[model samples]
Target: MKYSSKNAQETEKLGKKLVSKLRGGETIALTGDLGSGKTVFAKGVAKALGIRKKITSPTFVLWRLYQIPKPGRIKYLCHIDLYRLTQSQDILALGINEYWQRKDTVCLIEWAEKIKRFLPRKNLFLVKFEISDLNTRKIIIDGVSDVRS
Candidate 1:
């Protein structure tokens, strides 16, 4: 569905809420302009996964892996950023694609439009953000049931 956030905090809250239904092996494609709250939403998901480390976009290094502190079936969080790459080959060398289907890991990719063709056809979530004025955002989520529930 879709959601409107009045500010960063609200956007993050929505992110945490959306992630509650994830059980791992899920890939989330987060897309939007810079400073559109993609990273903030990711932090919310990280918080729900019991990750304590600060969450930051992997724009330079390309990807960051975090271990779920209280691991159960979901043991890892793989966060990737493709903002710096104009071509898919630049990202393929990172071998980050292997995380797409790992049962114990949840993959979140920012600027996923860079490699949309390479993503799994199923079990994927697309979170799109749009700037709505200076402190607001319109977020749309697809590929699953209503996150509002």
Candidate 2:
């Protein structure tokens, strides 16, 4: 599916709406340029998961885990940033595989093209972002079809 966002807010809403159909154990692979709306979309996902603190790109720390407050199907949200890493082996060295595909967790990876082949295909949602213009983003989604408007 292809989605166009006029601004960051629209991109974020699209992310929130998409997650509404996700039960758990899903991996979202986000790919795009530095100023793309990847992190903005993630913020929407976090909000939908009931996390209100705030989420930022984990470019330095590598990854950040957000604990969902609940008795829900998803207990944790693993936000991974692969911007600093160049290969899948680096991801393995950090033991990122342990976090993905967990029954009680949802994994969202930024710069995911770096490790796309290593992710579980059956449950991975590939989201590619293309910056159309200032404040406008074109997003292409593959793998899932339940995203609502």
Candidate 3:
């Protein structure tokens, strides 16, 4: 657990304080690189799952679900982007393990080490961005221990 984000609106306010301690079938794997904010931390976890539209970077439409408006424990947020999918059979022909084994869903996988063997090491969560200069941003978050400020 680490964080730095001196920009992109403090990495979307640390992705809305890490989605208020998410409560859903989480996945969140996101590594970093190109532009390094990862859709501004997925538009702060799609504005804390209320998702007011406009949260781009499915990187040419690889994924993008975002629903969340019911009696919620998070209805959906998918948002995957494996940097244009070279193949892992195109991430299993785009099912993505049925949005990371949906249980009201909350996926969020940017490059995700390019589908690191199709994730799922049991609940999984790995953030890792590191630019640390042009508007800083170090963020680590492996198991996440309240991700200090």
Candidate 4:
């Protein structure tokens, strides 16, 4: 699906809507240029997951983990930024493979284009964002699975 956002708030709202449909073990690969509001979308997802902590870009830290409590259970959101890494082995050494191997946690990755070769062929969501203007963005979401009701 494609969504157009007039501003950061609108982009985040779209992210929240998408987050509501998310389940454990989902991996989202977010690709976009710098300043394209990728972290804004991630904040929306974090909010929908019942996380109250401040959400910040993990570009410098490489990754950040958050815990969401819902219905007496806890779920994990693993946010990763691969913009600084020059090799896939750097990711592997960080135990990123473990995140992909599990079906109980949700992983959100930024700069995903750098590691597209390592992602799974199925059950993954890829979101691409393009800056159309200073306050506008075009977001495309693909490879999302239909949730069974």
State the lDDT of candidate 3 residue by residue for 1-149, as single tens digits: 78787889988877777777778888888898988897898898788778888988877779978787653877888898889888756887786677675777889889889878878886677898989789998988786577434
TM-scores of all candidate predictions against the true structure: 0.95, 0.95, 0.32, 0.90
Runs in model 3 deviating more than 4 A are 1-9, 12-14, 17-35, 39-84, 93-95, 100-103, 111-133, 136-149
Clashes of 4: 0
lDDT of 4: 0.80
Residue 110: error of model 3 in Å? 0.9
Q: Pairing residues by index, what is the TM-score of model 2? A: 0.95
- Write one digit per residue (lDDT tens) for candidate 4, span 73-135: 327888898889799768887766666635667888889898888877666889899999999
Model 1, 1-149: lDDT tens digits are 88889998898887788777898899999999999999999999999888999999887899999999899888999999999988886777887766766999999999988888888877899999999999989999998777768
- Sort every candidate by TM-score, greatest first: 1, 2, 4, 3
Runs in model 1 lying further than 4 Å from the true structure? none
- TM-score for model 4? 0.90
The lDDT per prediction is: 0.89, 0.88, 0.81, 0.80
Write candidate 2's Cα lDDT for 1-149 as tens digits: 99889999999998898787778999989999998999999998999898887899998889999999863999899999999997677887876667779988999999998886787877788899999999889999888784765
lDDT of 2 at 51: 89
TM-score of 1: 0.95
TM-score of 3: 0.32
Error (Å) of candidate 2 at residue 45 is 0.6
Q: The CA-based lDDT of model 3 is what?
A: 0.81
- Pick the winner on lDDT between candidates 2 and 3: 2
